[model samples]
Target: MSRTTLTLGPLLYNWPAADWRDFYARIADEAPVDTVCIGEVVCSKRQPFYADVIPETIERLERAGKTVILSTLALPTLDRELKYCGSLAREASQMIEVNDISTIPALAKRPHAIGPLINVYNEAAAAFLIAGGAARIALPPELPLKSISAIVAAARNAVIEVWAFGRIPLAISARCYHARLHGRTKDSCQFVCEQDLDGLDVETLDGERFLAVNGVQTLSYSYCNLIFEARQLESLGVSALRLSPHTCDMVAVSQIFRDVLDGIREPSHAMRAMRTICSDAAFSNGFVHGTNGALYVLE
Candidate 1:
């Protein structure tokens, strides 16, 4: 099987600015990822807290021989948010990942990659992005195997990546659930989301854990695990596996995927190792298999 490169996706939670800085500093020195995406893709309010550290982090990662990509906000609503997206589009240090259509016009002529948050479910969307100067694309997590194969076929010459790890980001809303749960509006959110590093878990009325709320983004309850399907992904011509960051042992996680891709370890062994590091959340690969998003099938 051909080796699939690993990519460390941007941090999704609103961690302390110092914690955020330390995370990337460690990743630059230790993680085995080919690319590291840096920027705020969630709430725009969180950007100001760690905005100054972005340049240094990117420089540090670049110096360490890691490719850096700037990710745009997944859902831009305010005028300030649009301006921030434009600024990111005009950036010259690294390539930008378009997470929302609002960013497309600003990034029209520039070379950029489409992030998973943007809906690229069919051939038409994939072709449109490629025509608009998309050099690479990370397909949405909800896309099934058939759709993935079709999109890959549609963009045969362009680089294709998938959200192969972490909790699948399901949706983005204008209202902050964290604020809503606290009886506060988005403007008066009071930075409540920073309390949960992994996000606040939501459960169904039956007491079944269902999803998680992080500011305005909603994530799947189960961590998307594809350790057992690494070879299958490579067979489908997938070029990269995007591993979203969490407050866990990411260096070891990256090494596990690296060893599996390098043929030094088996999928079963990698699965066991992952369980040891992952927080007590269920694992699922059902969305990729064309079923409910939370089911996992072991081959």
Candidate 2:
């Protein structure tokens, strides 16, 4: 059986610089992933805090036999943000994963990656991206398995990736929800998003867990768990599983997925272990099954 490649997606939360460095360092030395995406994928304002540690993290991951890729911001609005994406596209030594389409022209002729944020819902979109020099494409998490299969079949040559774990990113906004909740505006806010490493929970009127709020990104309350579908995903032509980073033990999470893919552990056992690691979180496989994004569907 062929081994499915595992990838560490760029961290989406505003974690401390030291924590970010340590997390990547541990992943580089311990995780069994094939590729590690590093850089700021959320707000560019948070980039300066951890920009210095990225180079060292890249060096460590590369030295450990991991392909390191730089990720562009998911929503590039400001002039500086556009410039940052341009810089990433210009980096010759590393492959860049563009979360925003505005970074495409800058990466023209250069081999680049299309992040999950890009709306690649059809074969035409996938073909366009592949023709535009996309070497790899991480499909959006909300896509159903049939859509994924079709996209995978259409994107024959490029490496196809799926969101295997972590909170599903739902939307990106111009205003900061975290700041608004804390009674601050997008500009005047003092980085209140840093308070929630796993994202601030957004509950419903009845106090039920509903969504999560980052600076501007809105995420699903339940974590998307695909441990049980690893084999089926590989059978459908998915080459890699992109694991979004959270505050949990990501190395263990990667290991569990690796074990399941290798046929060394049952999905049930792995799911149980994962629940233990992520005690407060609920699991969801609904989007993959063509249902609601928050419900867990057992097949």
Candidate 3:
């Protein structure tokens, strides 16, 4: 097996500030991921809660020999949010990941990374970003394997990445579903989304777990597990596998990915170990196979 770098994406959920800090600290000290994207990409309201710890987190990860990329918000609706994104582009000397297209202007001429939220569906889209100083792209999770391969082939100068773990981010809304579910308005959310370390589960009327609500974002119930597809991904020119942060033991998760990538563990054995680690969460790679996004198909 050829070497493929693992990237730990930013913490999406609104975890307690101390818990968030401690999680990154542990990752820095023990996780095998080569790159770590820090900062918030979801709700700006939650950023203030953990904003203070980001600098220390960056320092710690850098000290641990991890490449750190600062992430911007996925939706830049408010003036403050846009300003914040601009500030990150101007002030952050390290590579920045643009989650929203609105932040692209701010990052022009600067080598930046494109987050999965940008929807690089075709070669043209990929080329546009690459021309705009994008050094890497984490492809959208919903894209089929064929499309991913096409984009990867088109991106000669940029490193191609895929979402290899964590829940699939289905959609993001202006309304706060977390607050709506709790009988409150978006303005009065009171940060209740903190209760679920993972996003709050949204079940169908038939009691089937279907989606999760994280403030303004909607996510898939099934965690995206690509342990079996690592070889295929690497062969397709994807040099990086992105593992989004979840409530699970990420250090163990990183170890599993590293072992699989290094040929130290068989894909089957790694999948079994992941099952044990994420017992409550179902796993899926159907989107990559061009079928239902929640179904798992093995080749």
Residue-wise C-alpha lDDT for candidate 3, range 1-299, written one tens digit per residue:
33679999888899999999999999999999999999989899998888899889999999999999998899989999999999889888889999998888887668999999988999999998898799999999999999999998889789889999999899998999999999998899999999988999889999998999899999999999999999889888888999999989999999999999888999999999999999898999999999999999978
Q: Clashing pairs in model 1? A: none
Which regions of candidate 1 fall more than 4 Å away from where they truly are?
A: none
Model 2 Cα lDDT, one tens digit per residue, 1-299? 34689999999999999999999999989999999998888898899999898888889999999999998899999998998798779865899999998999998668889999999998899998899899999999999999999998888889999999999999999999998998999998799999999999889999988899999999999999999898899999899999999999999999999999888999999999999999988889899999999999989
Query: What are the models' TM-scores?
Result: 0.97, 0.98, 0.98
Question: What is every candidate's alpha-carbon RMSD to the true fold?
Answer: 1.2, 0.9, 1.0
Instruction: Quantify how close model 1 is to the true structure by its C-alpha RMSD in Å.
Output: 1.2
The lDDT values for all models are 0.89, 0.92, 0.92
Q: For model 1, how does the per-residue alpha-carbon lDDT over 5-123 read when each residue is reduced to its tens digit?
A: 89899899999999999999999999999999988899999999998898899889999999999998998889999998988797655899989988888775677889999888898
At residue 170, candidate 1 shows an lDDT of 92
**lDDT of residue 264 for candidate 3:** 94
Error of 3 at 298 (Å): 2.7
